[model samples]
Target: MGREYRCRIQGGPDRDAIRQLREGIRLDGQVSRFERIRHQGGRGANRWYEVVVCEGRYREIRRMWSAVGCRVNRLIRTRYGDLVLPRSLKAGQLRELNRAEVKALLRSVDVSHSGRRSSASSA
Candidate 1:
């Protein structure tokens, strides 16, 4: 769940461009859908759309938009799966957690093999 991503509003002024970008990504990447977000920038009169992708590859989305001559000015990863950077954590600061917290994470995984083993033993 530590996957990285590049997020952007593809294409220029035409509002429909966002829709096109969404469709293109689905077709090219073979994904069914991606979550869309809207935000108001400090200097802007209109709203902006942000696209989210799970797979992280540097500038992957930006390069895709650049293929059509569109520029992506803002790119930031706001979330990484279940882990969200704490608001208190600044740019260069870091937080170190104990080993128990790390091992607890593995308990969260739902492996299908466990279910199969239980069923076979009960038979």
Candidate 2:
């Protein structure tokens, strides 16, 4: 697993397209744990989706939605490895993880030590 995203998307992809997406999406890596959480009240039939994907492939989420004829209105990184973004945080904010959390996050990627600090450390 890599970055987990909670995204708000609009546009109504028909059943077939939904099924196609549910089957799997081929980005840089496979899109996993893809699920529509709920219909958030907004214009354009906005809905939320949770998905897990490894590696960034240049706006891969937008590309994935576009492939299914959907439009992503908002995309937020909810989790990375075992680290979950706290709800208490607001937009454009950051938080430092605890030692245990840091360890868990590192373990998730099978890295005991990374030469560079991770952006996940200040999420």
Candidate 3:
């Protein structure tokens, strides 16, 4: 139902690998590494692969696979800490914080539009 593959480089994965993967998917859906880069076990052992999914709807990554005759099987989100939506924030739901919290947040922002004149002006 699915395919899985791993690529172990000599120094582990890096931004270039990630970029190549993204570009490959964007252009042709095929995912692979640079020829010069070495992988563990070599050949079938280290080479990446594709998968065939039965589902109709696919995600952003899956859409890229359409160009390469391969389907993404395993996807690990590495930036969930910064982007993942918290359950506390609900759709169409807006809540206000306490006065102290509001003040703290506003204190950081430079609101020159407050229109408040300086306390000490020319005599």
Question: Using lDDT as the measure, which candidate wins?
Answer: 2
| Per-prediction TM-score to the true structure, in the order listed | 0.51, 0.68, 0.25
List the global CA lDDT of all models: 0.49, 0.70, 0.36
The superposed Cα distance between candidate 1 and the true structure at residue 100, in angstroms, equals 9.1
Writing each residue's lDDT as its tens digit, candidate 3 over 1-123 gives: 122223222222345554454444343353432222223333432334322222223354444433343444443321121133235665566556667654544443422235443334312
List candidate 1 stretches off by more than 4 Å: 1-13, 26-34, 42-48, 67-69, 87-94, 97-123
Estimate the overall C-alpha local distance difference test score of candidate 2.
0.70
Write the candidate numbers in order of decreasing TM-score: 2, 1, 3
Inter-residue clash pairs, candidate 2: none
Could you give candidate 2's per-residue lDDT for residues 1-123 as a string of tens digits? 567787788876677776766666776565632443333345558877676666546787778878888998888888766788887888899888888987787676655475555566545
Candidates sorted on lDDT, descending: 2, 1, 3
In candidate 1, position 48 carries an lDDT of: 41
- Candidate 1 Cα RMSD (Å): 6.3
Count clashing pairs, candidate 2.
Answer: 0
